[model samples]
Target: MHQRNISTRLKRRRAGDPMREFDALPPELRRWLAEASLPWSPRSARRIWRQGLKTGGVDEALRRLESAEVATLKRDRLAQL
Candidate 1:
């Protein structure tokens, strides 16, 4: 239930050069990108990200988002039923 200063983490990430140009992103965009990189079941990933927001880091949050996006894409593909 603790909130980490994501800005600080981002600054560190930028300094480390693990990611280039993330500095220009808004927090929401950054979070979304992080989510897009996770490997999990779509629904489960969304749930995990929601939970992670309560106590997890940005990386964890991103993984969940990624899963959720995948799930959504799959669902959409199936919707032409």
Candidate 2:
């Protein structure tokens, strides 16, 4: 497979059906994704979404996603150092 970027450590083979996973996302999350910096895989997003839902609720899940993005950015930044 083609490499997107070399420095970042986060990468995974996308599992399951992407279209169905994306379509199942709440509209708010889809909109949030529109503004996201990371190209979040559908499976990852859904996993986090469901995890957040289980732990708290939609708002909590959104917060978790934002946190995940920030953490990824930090990791990429460190990789560049």
Candidate 3:
């Protein structure tokens, strides 16, 4: 369901082009994507890092990355259920 939500949101963005679509999302959602391990490429992580740098500078980007780790834990818990 979480995966589906991400996909659906992405589909509505930037002519179905994922990179542009991803770039279009807000920081919170981008952080969520960075943390979620659903068949993503290393480039996606790089993109999130770049987005972080662009919007809020290095510190904010790092903070977002840190928050992303928390999502991993949540995703794992959800998977277990």
Best by lDDT: 2
Ranking by lDDT: 2, 3, 1
Clashing pairs in 1: 34-62, 35-62, 35-66, 38-63
Model 3, which residues run further than 4 Å from truth?
A: 1-41
Per-residue lDDT tens digits of candidate 2, residues 2-60? 33323456665777887887888888788767677777877787788788889999899
- For model 1, how does the per-residue alpha-carbon lDDT over 1-81 read when each residue is reduced to its tens digit? 422322211111112332444544447645565545222233343455556676777666765565655675566556645
| Cα RMSD, each candidate | 14.1, 5.5, 8.9
Angstrom error of the Cα, residue 68, model 1: value is 0.4
Q: For model 3, what is the alpha-carbon lDDT of residue 35?
A: 58
Error of 3 at 68 (Å): 1.6
Assess candidate 1 and give its TM-score to the true structure.
0.40
Better of 1 and 3 by TM-score: 3
Each prediction's TM-score versus the true structure: 0.40, 0.75, 0.44
What local distance difference test score does each model get?
A: 0.48, 0.77, 0.56
- Which digits, one per residue and each the tens of the lDDT, describe model 3 over residues 1-81? 344223211212123467776687667556655656353433555566677889897677666655664575466567667
